[model samples]
Target: MELTLAQEKALNALVYFAERIKPLYLTKAIKLLYMADEQAIRDTGVPITWLDYKAWRFGPVPEDVYNKVKQVDNLQKLDAGDGVLYSLKVSDAPADLPEGLVLNPIRPFNDDEFSDYEIEILQKVIDRYGKLTSEQLVDILHQEGTLWHRVVQANNLKQQFELKSNRSDYIIEFTDLLDTDYKKAAFEVAYQSHLMQQNLM
Candidate 1:
Protein backbone atom coordinates (compact mmCIF):
# COMPACT_ATOMS: atom_id res chain seq x y z
CA MET A 1 0.00 0.00 0.00
CA GLU A 2 1.08 3.55 -0.66
CA LEU A 3 2.12 5.42 2.46
CA THR A 4 -0.15 8.30 3.42
CA LEU A 5 1.51 11.53 4.46
CA ALA A 6 0.81 10.71 8.09
CA GLN A 7 2.26 7.22 7.64
CA GLU A 8 5.34 8.77 6.09
CA LYS A 9 5.74 10.93 9.14
CA ALA A 10 5.26 7.90 11.34
CA LEU A 11 7.97 6.00 9.45
CA ASN A 12 10.28 8.97 9.86
CA ALA A 13 9.49 8.94 13.56
CA LEU A 14 10.58 5.31 13.66
CA VAL A 15 13.78 6.39 12.00
CA TYR A 16 14.24 9.22 14.46
CA PHE A 17 14.01 6.92 17.45
CA ALA A 18 16.23 4.30 15.81
CA GLU A 19 18.89 6.93 15.38
CA ARG A 20 18.91 8.05 19.01
CA ILE A 21 18.39 4.72 20.74
CA LYS A 22 21.03 2.10 20.15
CA PRO A 23 19.70 -1.31 19.13
CA LEU A 24 16.18 0.13 19.10
CA TYR A 25 13.70 -2.69 19.19
CA LEU A 26 10.53 -2.60 17.10
CA THR A 27 8.08 -2.73 19.99
CA LYS A 28 9.92 -0.05 21.94
CA ALA A 29 10.04 2.24 18.89
CA ILE A 30 6.29 1.79 18.45
CA LYS A 31 5.66 2.51 22.11
CA LEU A 32 7.75 5.67 22.00
CA LEU A 33 5.78 6.86 18.96
CA TYR A 34 2.54 6.18 20.79
CA MET A 35 3.81 8.14 23.77
CA ALA A 36 4.69 11.10 21.59
CA ASP A 37 1.28 11.03 19.94
CA GLU A 38 -0.42 10.65 23.31
CA GLN A 39 1.51 13.57 24.80
CA ALA A 40 0.77 15.73 21.77
CA ILE A 41 -2.92 14.96 22.00
CA ARG A 42 -2.88 15.85 25.66
CA ASP A 43 -1.13 19.16 25.11
CA THR A 44 -2.47 20.34 21.74
CA GLY A 45 -5.73 18.40 21.21
CA VAL A 46 -4.06 16.83 18.17
CA PRO A 47 -1.74 13.86 17.61
CA ILE A 48 1.72 14.47 16.23
CA THR A 49 1.73 11.56 13.79
CA TRP A 50 -2.03 11.34 13.35
CA LEU A 51 -1.70 7.55 13.58
CA ASP A 52 -4.75 5.61 14.73
CA TYR A 53 -3.75 3.77 17.89
CA LYS A 54 -5.58 0.69 19.12
CA ALA A 55 -5.86 -0.89 22.54
CA TRP A 56 -3.59 -3.88 22.26
CA ARG A 57 -2.43 -6.30 24.91
CA PHE A 58 0.98 -4.69 25.25
CA GLY A 59 -0.28 -1.13 25.12
CA PRO A 60 -1.43 1.17 22.36
CA VAL A 61 -0.30 -0.11 18.96
CA PRO A 62 -0.61 1.92 15.81
CA GLU A 63 -1.42 -0.97 13.46
CA ASP A 64 -0.34 0.80 10.30
CA VAL A 65 2.90 1.87 11.85
CA TYR A 66 3.40 -1.59 13.27
CA ASN A 67 2.86 -3.14 9.89
CA LYS A 68 5.17 -0.63 8.26
CA VAL A 69 7.88 -1.36 10.75
CA LYS A 70 7.48 -5.05 10.07
CA GLN A 71 8.00 -4.35 6.41
CA VAL A 72 11.58 -3.22 7.04
CA ASP A 73 12.77 -5.78 4.53
CA ASN A 74 10.87 -4.01 1.77
CA LEU A 75 11.14 -0.38 2.87
CA GLN A 76 13.85 0.34 0.35
CA LYS A 77 11.23 0.05 -2.41
CA LEU A 78 9.12 2.90 -1.08
CA ASP A 79 9.98 6.20 -2.69
CA ALA A 80 7.50 8.74 -1.42
CA GLY A 81 9.01 12.03 -2.41
CA ASP A 82 9.18 14.82 0.18
CA GLY A 83 8.85 12.28 2.97
CA VAL A 84 11.70 11.09 5.14
CA LEU A 85 13.94 9.06 2.90
CA TYR A 86 15.46 6.01 4.54
CA SER A 87 15.66 2.24 4.74
CA LEU A 88 15.62 -0.08 7.74
CA LYS A 89 17.80 -3.13 8.33
CA VAL A 90 16.07 -5.51 10.63
CA SER A 91 18.29 -7.36 13.05
CA ASP A 92 17.78 -11.10 13.24
CA ALA A 93 14.96 -12.14 15.53
CA PRO A 94 12.60 -15.02 16.00
CA ALA A 95 9.24 -14.90 14.25
CA ASP A 96 7.44 -13.75 17.38
CA LEU A 97 10.09 -11.19 18.27
CA PRO A 98 10.12 -12.39 21.89
CA GLU A 99 13.31 -10.45 22.48
CA GLY A 100 11.82 -7.57 20.45
CA LEU A 101 12.84 -6.68 16.89
CA VAL A 102 15.82 -4.39 16.47
CA LEU A 103 15.81 -1.71 13.77
CA ASN A 104 18.86 0.04 12.43
CA PRO A 105 18.35 3.27 10.53
CA ILE A 106 20.21 3.54 7.24
CA ARG A 107 19.62 7.25 6.63
CA PRO A 108 19.38 10.51 8.51
CA PHE A 109 16.01 11.46 10.03
CA ASN A 110 14.33 14.25 8.07
CA ASP A 111 12.97 16.98 10.32
CA ASP A 112 11.41 18.79 7.37
CA GLU A 113 8.50 16.34 7.47
CA PHE A 114 7.32 17.70 10.83
CA SER A 115 6.31 20.96 12.47
CA ASP A 116 8.19 22.69 15.28
CA TYR A 117 5.64 21.54 17.84
CA GLU A 118 5.91 18.00 16.52
CA ILE A 119 9.69 18.07 16.90
CA GLU A 120 9.31 19.26 20.48
CA ILE A 121 6.81 16.52 21.24
CA LEU A 122 9.07 13.83 19.74
CA GLN A 123 12.01 15.05 21.79
CA LYS A 124 9.85 15.09 24.88
CA VAL A 125 8.79 11.49 24.26
CA ILE A 126 12.39 10.44 23.84
CA ASP A 127 13.48 12.30 26.93
CA ARG A 128 10.69 10.78 29.00
CA TYR A 129 10.56 7.24 27.64
CA GLY A 130 13.78 6.84 25.72
CA LYS A 131 15.62 5.15 28.54
CA LEU A 132 12.98 2.56 29.28
CA THR A 133 13.07 -0.98 27.94
CA SER A 134 10.20 -2.41 25.87
CA GLU A 135 8.86 -4.36 28.82
CA GLN A 136 9.14 -1.32 31.07
CA LEU A 137 7.20 0.74 28.56
CA VAL A 138 4.54 -1.92 28.52
CA ASP A 139 4.36 -1.73 32.31
CA ILE A 140 3.72 1.99 32.12
CA LEU A 141 0.92 1.46 29.61
CA HIS A 142 -0.63 -1.20 31.81
CA GLN A 143 -1.00 1.24 34.69
CA GLU A 144 -4.55 1.79 35.95
CA GLY A 145 -5.16 5.29 34.62
CA THR A 146 -3.52 4.90 31.23
CA LEU A 147 -5.61 5.02 28.07
CA TRP A 148 -4.71 1.41 27.18
CA HIS A 149 -5.72 0.20 30.61
CA ARG A 150 -8.99 2.12 30.48
CA VAL A 151 -9.91 0.58 27.14
CA VAL A 152 -9.04 -2.88 28.31
CA GLN A 153 -11.07 -2.38 31.47
CA ALA A 154 -14.08 -0.82 29.73
CA ASN A 155 -14.25 -3.83 27.42
CA ASN A 156 -13.91 -6.33 30.25
CA LEU A 157 -10.82 -7.79 28.62
CA LYS A 158 -8.17 -6.75 31.06
CA GLN A 159 -7.67 -10.31 32.31
CA GLN A 160 -8.16 -12.06 28.99
CA PHE A 161 -6.41 -9.74 26.60
CA GLU A 162 -5.11 -11.30 23.38
CA LEU A 163 -2.53 -9.88 21.03
CA LYS A 164 -3.35 -9.30 17.33
CA SER A 165 -6.85 -10.61 17.71
CA ASN A 166 -9.66 -8.70 16.04
CA ARG A 167 -12.05 -9.52 18.89
CA SER A 168 -9.75 -7.94 21.51
CA ASP A 169 -8.72 -4.73 19.81
CA TYR A 170 -10.39 -1.35 20.23
CA ILE A 171 -9.61 1.83 18.38
CA ILE A 172 -8.20 4.50 20.67
CA GLU A 173 -10.03 7.83 20.33
CA PHE A 174 -7.89 10.95 20.33
CA THR A 175 -10.55 12.90 22.19
CA ASP A 176 -10.27 10.45 25.06
CA LEU A 177 -6.79 11.81 25.73
CA LEU A 178 -8.02 15.33 26.44
CA ASP A 179 -8.82 16.35 30.01
CA THR A 180 -11.59 18.90 29.53
CA ASP A 181 -14.91 18.70 27.72
CA TYR A 182 -13.99 21.84 25.81
CA LYS A 183 -10.77 20.27 24.65
CA LYS A 184 -12.57 17.14 23.52
CA ALA A 185 -15.03 19.19 21.47
CA ALA A 186 -12.19 21.21 20.00
CA PHE A 187 -10.42 18.01 19.11
CA GLU A 188 -13.48 16.81 17.23
CA VAL A 189 -13.40 20.00 15.17
CA ALA A 190 -9.70 19.69 14.51
CA TYR A 191 -10.09 16.01 13.59
CA GLN A 192 -12.83 16.80 11.14
CA SER A 193 -10.69 19.47 9.55
CA HIS A 194 -7.81 17.04 9.31
CA LEU A 195 -9.99 14.50 7.58
CA MET A 196 -11.14 17.09 5.07
CA GLN A 197 -7.56 18.06 4.35
CA GLN A 198 -6.58 14.43 3.85
CA ASN A 199 -9.53 13.92 1.49
CA LEU A 200 -8.38 16.81 -0.66
CA MET A 201 -5.06 15.06 -1.24
Candidate 2:
Protein backbone atom coordinates (compact mmCIF):
# COMPACT_ATOMS: atom_id res chain seq x y z
CA MET A 1 0.00 0.00 0.00
CA GLU A 2 1.10 3.53 -0.69
CA LEU A 3 2.02 5.21 2.55
CA THR A 4 -0.28 7.97 3.76
CA LEU A 5 1.02 11.50 4.36
CA ALA A 6 0.92 10.86 8.08
CA GLN A 7 3.19 7.88 7.74
CA GLU A 8 5.67 10.00 5.85
CA LYS A 9 5.48 12.61 8.56
CA ALA A 10 5.98 9.90 11.13
CA LEU A 11 9.39 9.05 9.78
CA ASN A 12 10.27 12.72 9.67
CA ALA A 13 9.21 13.01 13.27
CA LEU A 14 11.30 10.00 14.22
CA VAL A 15 14.28 11.64 12.69
CA TYR A 16 13.50 14.80 14.61
CA PHE A 17 13.28 13.12 17.99
CA ALA A 18 16.40 11.11 17.26
CA GLU A 19 18.27 14.36 16.83
CA ARG A 20 16.67 16.41 19.57
CA ILE A 21 15.98 13.63 22.06
CA LYS A 22 17.96 10.49 21.53
CA PRO A 23 17.04 6.91 22.52
CA LEU A 24 13.25 7.25 22.06
CA TYR A 25 11.33 3.99 21.94
CA LEU A 26 8.91 3.13 19.12
CA THR A 27 5.71 3.47 21.13
CA LYS A 28 6.60 6.86 22.61
CA ALA A 29 7.35 8.14 19.12
CA ILE A 30 3.88 7.17 17.96
CA LYS A 31 2.24 8.69 21.02
CA LEU A 32 4.11 11.94 20.51
CA LEU A 33 2.79 12.25 16.97
CA TYR A 34 -0.71 11.31 18.02
CA MET A 35 -0.70 13.88 20.80
CA ALA A 36 0.44 16.62 18.42
CA ASP A 37 -2.16 15.87 15.76
CA GLU A 38 -4.90 15.38 18.32
CA GLN A 39 -4.17 18.66 20.07
CA ALA A 40 -3.70 20.62 16.88
CA ILE A 41 -7.01 19.42 15.50
CA ARG A 42 -8.87 20.60 18.60
CA ASP A 43 -7.22 23.97 19.00
CA THR A 44 -6.86 25.01 15.36
CA GLY A 45 -9.64 23.12 13.54
CA VAL A 46 -6.93 21.31 11.59
CA PRO A 47 -4.39 18.72 12.65
CA ILE A 48 -0.65 19.00 12.35
CA THR A 49 -0.89 15.87 10.27
CA TRP A 50 -4.03 14.49 8.64
CA LEU A 51 -3.64 11.14 10.34
CA ASP A 52 -6.82 9.44 11.50
CA TYR A 53 -6.31 7.81 14.89
CA LYS A 54 -8.26 4.97 16.46
CA ALA A 55 -8.75 4.20 20.10
CA TRP A 56 -6.31 1.33 20.39
CA ARG A 57 -5.68 -0.58 23.60
CA PHE A 58 -2.49 1.30 24.20
CA GLY A 59 -3.91 4.60 23.03
CA PRO A 60 -4.92 6.50 19.90
CA VAL A 61 -2.75 5.71 16.90
CA PRO A 62 -2.77 6.18 13.17
CA GLU A 63 -3.14 2.68 11.75
CA ASP A 64 -0.71 3.59 9.03
CA VAL A 65 1.87 4.46 11.66
CA TYR A 66 1.40 1.24 13.61
CA ASN A 67 1.94 -0.86 10.50
CA LYS A 68 4.87 1.11 9.16
CA VAL A 69 6.96 0.84 12.29
CA LYS A 70 7.03 -2.92 12.05
CA GLN A 71 8.93 -3.05 8.78
CA VAL A 72 10.31 0.39 7.98
CA ASP A 73 14.08 0.49 7.61
CA ASN A 74 14.03 4.12 8.72
CA LEU A 75 13.93 2.94 12.32
CA GLN A 76 17.03 1.41 13.84
CA LYS A 77 17.59 -0.68 16.93
CA LEU A 78 19.85 0.99 19.41
CA ASP A 79 22.40 -0.70 21.63
CA ALA A 80 21.18 0.83 24.86
CA GLY A 81 23.53 -1.44 26.87
CA ASP A 82 20.67 -3.56 28.25
CA GLY A 83 17.08 -2.86 27.23
CA VAL A 84 16.02 -1.98 23.64
CA LEU A 85 15.74 1.50 22.26
CA TYR A 86 14.91 2.84 18.77
CA SER A 87 16.03 5.79 16.73
CA LEU A 88 15.85 6.98 13.15
CA LYS A 89 18.08 5.41 10.55
CA VAL A 90 20.44 7.65 8.67
CA SER A 91 19.46 9.34 5.43
CA ASP A 92 20.51 12.69 4.01
CA ALA A 93 16.91 13.59 3.21
CA PRO A 94 15.91 17.06 4.36
CA ALA A 95 12.93 15.87 6.42
CA ASP A 96 10.69 17.91 4.14
CA LEU A 97 6.94 17.62 4.42
CA PRO A 98 5.20 15.49 1.83
CA GLU A 99 2.81 17.01 -0.70
CA GLY A 100 -0.91 16.57 -1.51
CA LEU A 101 -2.26 16.56 2.02
CA VAL A 102 -4.32 18.89 4.24
CA LEU A 103 -2.43 20.48 7.14
CA ASN A 104 -3.03 22.36 10.37
CA PRO A 105 -4.79 25.74 9.93
CA ILE A 106 -2.58 27.73 12.29
CA ARG A 107 1.08 26.89 11.72
CA PRO A 108 4.50 28.20 12.62
CA PHE A 109 5.59 29.57 9.23
CA ASN A 110 4.88 29.68 5.52
CA ASP A 111 5.88 26.23 4.22
CA ASP A 112 4.66 23.21 6.12
CA GLU A 113 6.64 20.27 7.20
CA PHE A 114 4.87 21.69 10.18
CA SER A 115 3.89 25.20 11.12
CA ASP A 116 5.94 27.13 13.65
CA TYR A 117 3.05 26.71 16.05
CA GLU A 118 2.95 23.00 15.46
CA ILE A 119 6.67 22.82 16.09
CA GLU A 120 6.18 24.75 19.29
CA ILE A 121 3.49 22.34 20.37
CA LEU A 122 5.68 19.42 19.41
CA GLN A 123 8.54 20.81 21.45
CA LYS A 124 6.34 21.00 24.48
CA VAL A 125 5.01 17.47 23.95
CA ILE A 126 8.40 15.95 23.30
CA ASP A 127 10.02 17.65 26.26
CA ARG A 128 7.34 16.33 28.56
CA TYR A 129 6.61 12.92 27.08
CA GLY A 130 10.02 12.06 25.71
CA LYS A 131 11.55 11.57 29.12
CA LEU A 132 9.05 8.92 30.17
CA THR A 133 9.05 5.20 29.40
CA SER A 134 6.82 3.61 26.76
CA GLU A 135 4.75 1.99 29.48
CA GLN A 136 4.23 5.36 31.09
CA LEU A 137 3.00 6.82 27.84
CA VAL A 138 0.53 3.96 27.48
CA ASP A 139 -0.87 4.65 30.93
CA ILE A 140 -1.24 8.31 30.07
CA LEU A 141 -3.21 7.48 26.94
CA HIS A 142 -5.46 5.09 28.81
CA GLN A 143 -6.62 7.72 31.27
CA GLU A 144 -10.36 8.37 31.56
CA GLY A 145 -11.81 11.23 29.43
CA THR A 146 -9.01 10.83 26.88
CA LEU A 147 -9.84 9.99 23.29
CA TRP A 148 -9.04 6.31 23.59
CA HIS A 149 -11.19 5.78 26.66
CA ARG A 150 -14.09 7.78 25.21
CA VAL A 151 -14.03 5.84 21.97
CA VAL A 152 -13.99 2.50 23.75
CA GLN A 153 -16.65 3.54 26.24
CA ALA A 154 -18.86 5.05 23.54
CA ASN A 155 -18.68 2.01 21.29
CA ASN A 156 -18.40 -0.58 24.02
CA LEU A 157 -15.28 -1.91 22.40
CA LYS A 158 -13.43 -4.40 24.54
CA GLN A 159 -9.78 -4.16 25.43
CA GLN A 160 -7.29 -5.19 22.76
CA PHE A 161 -10.06 -4.18 20.35
CA GLU A 162 -9.94 -6.24 17.22
CA LEU A 163 -10.62 -4.47 13.93
CA LYS A 164 -10.25 -5.69 10.41
CA SER A 165 -8.24 -3.46 8.12
CA ASN A 166 -11.20 -3.24 5.76
CA ARG A 167 -13.26 -1.64 8.53
CA SER A 168 -10.70 1.08 9.24
CA ASP A 169 -11.98 4.00 7.15
CA TYR A 170 -15.55 2.90 7.74
CA ILE A 171 -15.45 3.86 11.42
CA ILE A 172 -15.11 7.52 10.56
CA GLU A 173 -18.72 7.89 9.50
CA PHE A 174 -20.04 6.52 12.77
CA THR A 175 -17.79 8.43 15.12
CA ASP A 176 -18.13 12.11 15.86
CA LEU A 177 -15.16 11.91 18.21
CA LEU A 178 -13.51 14.01 15.57
CA ASP A 179 -15.92 16.87 16.13
CA THR A 180 -14.36 20.10 17.38
CA ASP A 181 -15.85 20.05 20.83
CA TYR A 182 -14.87 16.49 21.49
CA LYS A 183 -11.49 17.16 20.01
CA LYS A 184 -11.09 20.18 22.29
CA ALA A 185 -12.06 18.18 25.33
CA ALA A 186 -9.81 15.33 24.31
CA PHE A 187 -6.91 17.73 23.85
CA GLU A 188 -7.45 19.16 27.30
CA VAL A 189 -7.30 15.73 28.84
CA ALA A 190 -3.96 14.96 27.23
CA TYR A 191 -2.64 18.43 28.01
CA GLN A 192 -3.57 18.07 31.64
CA SER A 193 -1.78 14.76 31.71
CA HIS A 194 1.26 16.49 30.31
CA LEU A 195 1.11 19.07 33.08
CA MET A 196 0.83 16.40 35.71
CA GLN A 197 3.80 14.54 34.28
CA GLN A 198 5.83 17.74 34.30
CA ASN A 199 5.30 18.21 37.99
CA LEU A 200 6.37 14.68 38.80
CA MET A 201 9.48 15.07 36.70
Candidate 3:
Protein backbone atom coordinates (compact mmCIF):
# COMPACT_ATOMS: atom_id res chain seq x y z
CA MET A 1 0.00 0.00 0.00
CA GLU A 2 1.12 3.53 -0.70
CA LEU A 3 2.06 5.70 2.25
CA THR A 4 0.04 8.84 2.98
CA LEU A 5 1.70 12.12 3.97
CA ALA A 6 1.07 11.42 7.64
CA GLN A 7 2.48 7.91 7.26
CA GLU A 8 5.60 9.39 5.67
CA LYS A 9 5.90 11.75 8.61
CA ALA A 10 5.55 8.79 10.94
CA LEU A 11 8.49 7.05 9.25
CA ASN A 12 10.58 10.18 9.41
CA ALA A 13 9.81 10.50 13.11
CA LEU A 14 10.89 6.89 13.60
CA VAL A 15 14.10 7.58 11.67
CA TYR A 16 14.81 10.62 13.80
CA PHE A 17 14.43 8.56 16.98
CA ALA A 18 16.55 5.74 15.50
CA GLU A 19 19.33 8.20 14.74
CA ARG A 20 19.54 9.12 18.42
CA ILE A 21 19.03 5.72 20.04
CA LYS A 22 20.90 3.62 17.48
CA PRO A 23 18.55 0.72 16.75
CA LEU A 24 15.21 1.98 18.08
CA TYR A 25 12.82 -0.53 19.49
CA LEU A 26 9.66 -0.80 17.34
CA THR A 27 7.28 -0.73 20.31
CA LYS A 28 9.02 2.31 21.71
CA ALA A 29 8.86 4.05 18.34
CA ILE A 30 5.09 3.52 18.12
CA LYS A 31 4.52 4.67 21.68
CA LEU A 32 6.60 7.79 21.15
CA LEU A 33 4.64 8.61 18.02
CA TYR A 34 1.35 8.22 19.88
CA MET A 35 2.53 10.46 22.68
CA ALA A 36 3.64 13.06 20.16
CA ASP A 37 0.25 12.99 18.47
CA GLU A 38 -1.57 13.37 21.76
CA GLN A 39 0.64 16.28 22.78
CA ALA A 40 0.19 17.93 19.40
CA ILE A 41 -3.57 17.80 19.81
CA ARG A 42 -3.34 19.30 23.28
CA ASP A 43 -1.01 22.07 22.17
CA THR A 44 -2.33 22.91 18.72
CA GLY A 45 -5.68 21.15 18.32
CA VAL A 46 -4.01 19.18 15.55
CA PRO A 47 -1.95 16.01 15.48
CA ILE A 48 1.49 16.05 13.86
CA THR A 49 0.83 12.63 12.34
CA TRP A 50 -2.82 11.85 11.71
CA LEU A 51 -2.40 8.16 12.37
CA ASP A 52 -5.32 6.13 13.69
CA TYR A 53 -4.63 4.43 16.98
CA LYS A 54 -6.23 1.28 18.34
CA ALA A 55 -6.61 0.52 22.01
CA TRP A 56 -4.24 -2.42 21.97
CA ARG A 57 -3.26 -4.57 24.92
CA PHE A 58 -0.03 -2.70 25.53
CA GLY A 59 -1.32 0.77 24.77
CA PRO A 60 -2.53 2.95 21.92
CA VAL A 61 -1.09 1.40 18.74
CA PRO A 62 -0.94 2.92 15.31
CA GLU A 63 -1.85 -0.38 13.75
CA ASP A 64 -1.26 0.69 10.17
CA VAL A 65 2.24 1.99 10.81
CA TYR A 66 3.03 -0.98 13.03
CA ASN A 67 1.98 -3.39 10.28
CA LYS A 68 3.97 -1.43 7.72
CA VAL A 69 7.08 -1.76 9.89
CA LYS A 70 6.56 -5.49 10.16
CA GLN A 71 6.17 -5.65 6.41
CA VAL A 72 9.36 -3.65 5.89
CA ASP A 73 11.19 -5.83 8.40
CA ASN A 74 10.35 -8.87 6.31
CA LEU A 75 10.88 -7.23 2.90
CA GLN A 76 13.86 -5.11 4.02
CA LYS A 77 12.56 -2.08 2.10
CA LEU A 78 9.34 -0.25 1.28
CA ASP A 79 9.15 2.20 -1.58
CA ALA A 80 6.70 5.02 -0.93
CA GLY A 81 6.73 5.95 -4.61
CA ASP A 82 8.68 8.83 -6.22
CA GLY A 83 11.88 6.80 -5.56
CA VAL A 84 11.64 7.45 -1.80
CA LEU A 85 12.91 4.44 0.09
CA TYR A 86 12.20 3.46 3.68
CA SER A 87 14.04 0.44 4.96
CA LEU A 88 14.81 -1.18 8.30
CA LYS A 89 17.86 -3.14 9.33
CA VAL A 90 17.60 -5.65 12.11
CA SER A 91 20.03 -5.33 14.97
CA ASP A 92 21.02 -8.08 17.39
CA ALA A 93 18.49 -10.76 18.29
CA PRO A 94 18.12 -10.03 21.96
CA ALA A 95 15.91 -12.14 24.21
CA ASP A 96 13.08 -9.68 23.64
CA LEU A 97 13.80 -9.21 19.95
CA PRO A 98 10.56 -10.86 18.89
CA GLU A 99 8.56 -8.31 20.83
CA GLY A 100 11.07 -5.47 20.68
CA LEU A 101 12.06 -5.34 16.96
CA VAL A 102 15.38 -3.59 17.42
CA LEU A 103 15.76 -1.75 14.11
CA ASN A 104 17.89 0.93 12.49
CA PRO A 105 17.09 3.19 9.57
CA ILE A 106 18.91 2.53 6.31
CA ARG A 107 19.00 6.25 5.44
CA PRO A 108 18.87 9.62 7.10
CA PHE A 109 15.47 11.16 7.85
CA ASN A 110 14.29 14.11 5.75
CA ASP A 111 13.50 17.05 7.95
CA ASP A 112 12.36 19.05 4.92
CA GLU A 113 9.10 17.14 5.11
CA PHE A 114 8.22 18.76 8.43
CA SER A 115 7.35 22.29 9.52
CA ASP A 116 9.31 24.04 12.25
CA TYR A 117 6.56 23.53 14.80
CA GLU A 118 6.19 19.85 13.92
CA ILE A 119 9.91 19.25 14.32
CA GLU A 120 9.93 21.08 17.63
CA ILE A 121 7.02 19.01 18.94
CA LEU A 122 8.68 15.77 17.82
CA GLN A 123 11.92 16.68 19.54
CA LYS A 124 9.97 17.65 22.62
CA VAL A 125 8.33 14.25 22.71
CA ILE A 126 11.66 12.52 22.26
CA ASP A 127 13.17 14.59 25.02
CA ARG A 128 10.36 13.55 27.32
CA TYR A 129 10.02 9.86 26.39
CA GLY A 130 12.94 8.77 24.24
CA LYS A 131 14.86 7.13 27.05
CA LEU A 132 11.96 5.07 28.32
CA THR A 133 11.73 1.34 27.52
CA SER A 134 8.76 -0.12 25.63
CA GLU A 135 7.40 -1.70 28.80
CA GLN A 136 7.75 1.53 30.73
CA LEU A 137 5.95 3.48 28.02
CA VAL A 138 3.23 0.86 28.05
CA ASP A 139 2.83 1.34 31.77
CA ILE A 140 2.46 5.07 31.26
CA LEU A 141 -0.22 4.65 28.59
CA HIS A 142 -2.05 2.07 30.67
CA GLN A 143 -2.15 4.30 33.72
CA GLU A 144 -5.48 4.58 35.59
CA GLY A 145 -6.86 7.68 33.88
CA THR A 146 -5.17 7.49 30.47
CA LEU A 147 -7.28 7.31 27.31
CA TRP A 148 -5.96 3.84 26.59
CA HIS A 149 -6.92 2.72 30.07
CA ARG A 150 -10.39 4.23 29.69
CA VAL A 151 -10.99 2.38 26.43
CA VAL A 152 -9.82 -0.90 27.96
CA GLN A 153 -11.98 -0.32 30.97
CA ALA A 154 -15.06 0.51 28.91
CA ASN A 155 -14.56 -2.62 26.84
CA ASN A 156 -14.31 -4.71 30.00
CA LEU A 157 -17.48 -3.15 31.31
CA LYS A 158 -19.27 -3.87 28.08
CA GLN A 159 -18.19 -7.50 28.23
CA GLN A 160 -19.33 -7.77 31.80
CA PHE A 161 -22.81 -6.73 30.65
CA GLU A 162 -22.62 -9.29 27.77
CA LEU A 163 -22.65 -6.41 25.33
CA LYS A 164 -20.69 -6.49 22.09
CA SER A 165 -17.12 -5.62 22.85
CA ASN A 166 -13.68 -5.94 21.32
CA ARG A 167 -10.86 -4.64 23.47
CA SER A 168 -8.21 -4.10 20.81
CA ASP A 169 -10.69 -3.31 18.05
CA TYR A 170 -11.79 -0.01 19.54
CA ILE A 171 -10.40 3.18 18.13
CA ILE A 172 -8.98 5.47 20.79
CA GLU A 173 -10.01 9.04 20.07
CA PHE A 174 -7.10 11.42 20.49
CA THR A 175 -9.40 14.21 21.66
CA ASP A 176 -10.17 12.03 24.65
CA LEU A 177 -6.63 12.75 25.78
CA LEU A 178 -7.77 16.29 26.43
CA ASP A 179 -8.80 16.36 30.09
CA THR A 180 -11.55 18.98 29.98
CA ASP A 181 -14.90 19.32 28.21
CA TYR A 182 -13.88 22.73 26.87
CA LYS A 183 -10.77 21.22 25.30
CA LYS A 184 -12.80 18.41 23.78
CA ALA A 185 -15.29 20.83 22.23
CA ALA A 186 -12.46 22.97 20.89
CA PHE A 187 -10.82 19.91 19.38
CA GLU A 188 -14.09 18.82 17.80
CA VAL A 189 -14.27 22.10 15.94
CA ALA A 190 -10.65 21.82 14.80
CA TYR A 191 -11.11 18.19 13.78
CA GLN A 192 -14.20 18.92 11.76
CA SER A 193 -12.42 21.77 9.99
CA HIS A 194 -9.51 19.49 9.21
CA LEU A 195 -11.88 16.94 7.74
CA MET A 196 -13.41 19.60 5.53
CA GLN A 197 -9.99 20.66 4.23
CA GLN A 198 -9.06 17.07 3.52
CA ASN A 199 -12.24 16.67 1.52
CA LEU A 200 -11.45 19.78 -0.49
CA MET A 201 -8.05 18.33 -1.29
Best by lDDT: 1
Give residue 85's lDDT in candidate 3 (0 to 100).
Answer: 29
The residue-by-residue lDDT of candidate 1 on 69-157, one tens digit each, is 77656664665444344556677666765675788888888888688989888888889889988999999988988888888888877
Off by over 4 Å in 1: 75-85, 93-98, 162-167
Would you list the C-alpha lDDT of every candidate in the order shown? 0.79, 0.56, 0.75
Which pairs of residues collide in model 3?
A: none
Residue-level lDDT of model 2, residues 24-89, one tens digit each, is 555666788877766666566456655667666666767776666555433333332321113333
Supply candidate 3's per-residue lDDT for 63: 84
- The positional error of residue 31 in candidate 2, measured at the CA in angstroms, is 0.7
Global fold similarity of model 3 (TM-score): 0.79
Candidate 3, residues 36-120, lDDT tens digits: the string is: 8888888866787778899877788888878877677443444434422244565554885556577687788788867799888
Indicate the residue-level lDDT of 88 in model 2: 35
As for candidate 2, its clashing pairs are: 108-115, 108-116, 108-117, 109-116
Better of 1 and 3 by TM-score: 1
